[model samples]
Target chain A: MQWSHNMRFFQSYAMKKQLWIIVVIIIAAILPTIIGAFWINVAVEILIMGLFAVSFNMIFGYMGQLSFGHAAFYGVGAYTVGLLMAKLSIPFSLSLIAAMLSAGAFALIIGYFCIRLTGIYFAILTLSFGQLIYYIVFEWYSFTGGDNGLQGIAAPHLLSSVTAYYYFTLVIVIAALIVMWYISRSPFGYTMRAIRDNANRTRFLGINVKRYMLINFVIAGAFAGLAGGLWGPFNQSISPDLLNWTESGIPVFMTVIGGSASFLGPMVGSIIYTFLNAFVTGFTQYWPLIIGIVIMLIILFSPGGIQGLIDKWYKHSDSSDENIEL
Target chain B: METGGRNSGSKSEREEITGESMDFSLIFSQFLSGLSRGAMLFLIASGLSLIFGVMNILNFAHAALWLVGAYLAYTFWNLLQPYGFSLWVSIPLAAVALSAIGWAIERVLIRRIYNRTLSEQLVFTFAMILVIDNLIKIIWGVQDKAIVRPSIVASPVFIFGAPLDSYFIFVIFTGAVVAIGLWWFLSKTKYGHIIKAAVFSREMVSALGIPVPKIYTWVFVLGIFLAGLAGGVQAPIGSITLGMDNAVIIQAFIVVVIGGFGSLLGTLVGSIIVGEIYAFSILFWPDGAMILIFVVAAIMLIIRPWGLFGTPMRT
Candidate 1:
């Protein structure tokens, strides 16, 4: 009788949580309509970067590896889309697929070399690979338009309108997030976590750690490419600078600042960083300095990030029920 | 085997060009340029290797310090020019300024993060790069600055029948002097042994009444000083631009990685190898010169991930 009561209580709590999620989703759906044009555009950027960060988190947070060159995949995706649309006049859907495939290929090649090394060495190799991609893209002047980049990327008629494009991006991001969430909860994710926690022990258990990491890397790259594909049409241009190591640092910053411990941490980081970028750049060209100082403070003072602070506050306020999961 | 073939190929090419029984003169010119390039790399990579050796921290901001060194040299040159000062005076002055800045960074920021994770250390130093890059813009403006060579060393000298720039010779000489000085300090001096011992076991050194933190601060300062000195010297050869820091830093990183981080002799050999490769590759494969560095480093990792001289970590 006690077990039945406990199950009923949990069901009710789960239903309530689902309801809350539905409400948040509805709010997000209608947000662009209520916001100004400028804010809506910013929202588009936030959504794209948020997706990128979430994908990045799969490796950094879930897999316990930091890839310092994630932007290379993102740039590859953008360039693939831009080139396909500008040169071959491929349809939007096909171009998007191509972008993901290309980025996935890139991740596979880079990760083959990278996954063998751990910690700082992995970070450096990824960084070097990222720079290599940037240099190639920068130097291939005829095809990539050199440093000028590709412009006038064509979008499908349905996505021609800014509002329509925004909604399209919103739907794609939400679907991607759902798929990502499912994957995280799957057996593969558990193995990933196992490897991350103790790779040697995981290896002793007869699991091929490197292969799993490579697959995760490919998945992460594909998602980043998807975001980059969206970005090319949104901006109507793409540059080699997109692949710069400094740009790679953005996802890292977002993951760390948003809290790398939780599922939603990188998304939160993306949102905060997007807003911070939009807000700070409006006032000063010294944005790098401000962003640098803010990140430093976050590292020094709030190592666990915003989510961590919230968890602490929740624990303090609700001592009777301290087992809340976020 | 392939490298051997490439070397002989280049030598034959040199022989054909010079049209001589002995192409020693032609080879000598290549050697001279390689030495100069390697020396500059050494100045930067040694510092990077030393810091990693001691603290296990890959200081990204070291590159920014190089930029600071260049800009400071520019500023000091302009100021001292009115008072009849030379490039020599300005270069050393810039080095001192950088040392101060490096010391401040260690004491105020890096000193607190000795026990933090590697990711945190990288990001924190990366943040410093952003701050310093922007600060350079705010202080020095966005324009590239050029420094004229000192009048005393403005002309080329005929060495081994090659007209090498006097400034290049000076740079080579400075690098050699520093290399010898560092060698003496590390291998022959008591302080050098202390630093090495500290790198091997920090706790044991501390337990033996050594102020490990103080030693670390000084070592970091020394690293900074080298970076600054490199920038000051390089400023005359190339214009100081916004992106120069990243350009040099990446190359220096490749040098350190190839040489094996935390090993002085490794750094020396790595720099020379890289420098020679860079010098010759420009002649044979101009378009892919930069890519060659990455390729070599990749091969090195494949063959020996711990680097040529670096000790592998115990997992």
Candidate 2:
């Protein structure tokens, strides 16, 4: 009787989580209808970045592998789509797919070598590569437009309307997030967390720890690429700076700001960053100053961010999952 | 952004004013140019490499320090413009001023997170990039500023078959002097040996009653001095702008990687290699040079792992 009652409670909680996602989708789908195109553009950017940050969180939070070159994938996706449309006159969907493949291929090649180093070595190595990509884009004037970047990229007919584009982006992001959420809950996630908590123990348990990390790495790179792919049509242009180390820092900032441990934190962090940028930069050119200071204070104080704060509040009220580690 | 050029170039030059205008002597001048550029690179990369060695922190702000040095030189030059002593006086003054800034950076910002993760180090330094660059723009106004080699009536000297600029020669000489100074400081002096001792074993050094944190501050200050000197020397050669920090800093990191961390000799050699690549690439294929160096650094790391002379990771 006691076991059956616990099972029933678990099922009820699972159902509530699923319903929560649906509610979010419904609200997100109708958001642009209520707001203007300007806000919608900001929303689109935030959505793309949310996917990027969440993808980053998978590696940084779940796997405890910090990468400063995530922008390589992001840039590869954006540039792949941009180059295809610029030169080959490829279809929108096809270009996006190509973008994802290119990003994955690029990630695997870099990761093959980078995986050898752990800790700060790995981070700096990735960073150098990220800057290298940026330089390629900046200097390869003949092919990459030589820093002027690819201009005049436009959304496809289906995505011509802001409302339509918002809905389209929302659908894709929702599907991606659902997939990510599922992956996070699967046995794979358990193994990942184990590896993060103690790599030697997991390896002792017969897991190919490096292989597990590589799989998560490629997957993270692909989703970040997907974010980059979406950015192409939305912005209608791309630049090599998109893959620079500084640009790669975004998701890390967002991941930490959103509390990397929780799946929902990064998405919320992205929303917060976007909304803040919308109002803040409009007021002055020195907005990064304000944003940087705020993030510093957040890191210094909260460490786990808003989700971290929420967890602490919930903890005081006696939640069932008391073992949450930020 | 594609700055529109030929998707397919014409078979021949549209206008060739050249009738074998090349000079064999240009090779010597090119070598001289390479050395000068190498010196500037050495100054920047050495500072960055040292910081990486002792602190085990990848500072994103070193390039900003370079920018600050150049800006200080510019400001001092303007203040002392009417007086003939400005050019000679400004460089040392620029370096000294920036040392205080470096001290503040170490004490206030970097000290706070000495024990944090690499991601935290990266994030905090990155924040400085935003704050520092914006501070530069706010203070200087967003206009390009130039630091012309203080009007010293410099003349070119002929070496082998080519004439080399005096300023270029000075840069090369400055680099050598700095290298020797650093080496002697590290080897002969007690403090220098203590730093290397700390580098070899931080805990052992600390257990021996030395203050590791104080050593870190000194390392940071010394590194800052070198970076400021680099900026002061390069003032005449390049543009002084807020964002120049990013380019210089990235290049410095690449050099540090190739040279291996904490090895000044490696930094010097690495700078020369990168410098030669820069000079020759511009002479030949301009597009892929910068990217090619990065590719080289990546390949070097794969092969050597710890860099050419870098100490193995004991941490």
Across A16-51, the per-residue lDDT of candidate 2 in tens digits comes to 656877787788877876888899989988999999
As a TM-score, model 2 comes out at: 0.90
CA lDDT of A296 in candidate 2?
A: 79
Superposition error at A25 for model 2 (Å): 3.3
Q: Candidate 1 — which residues are off by over 4 angstroms?
A: A1-24, A317-326, B1-30, B158-163
lDDT top scorer: 1
Per-prediction DockQ comes to 0.46, 0.46
lDDT of 1 by residue, B1-315 (tens): 232233345555644544553356556767788889999999989998899888888898888888899899999998887665557899999999999999998999989878888888888888889899999999999998988776767776545444467688888988898899999999899999998887687889899999989999999999999988988888788788996887778778888878887889889999998888877777777756677777787677656777898878611
Q: Candidate 2, after superposition: displacement of residue A125 in Å? A: 1.9
Residue pairs in candidate 2 whose N, alpha carbon or C atoms collide under 3 angstroms: A145-B1, A145-B2, A145-B3, A147-B1, A148-B1, A149-B1, A149-B2
* Cα error, candidate 2, residue A110 (Å): 1.5
Q: What is candidate 1's lDDT per residue for A129-219, written digit by digit as tens?
A: 8877887888788889878999999689989887888899999999988888888878898888888889999999999999999999999
Top of the candidates by TM-score: 1
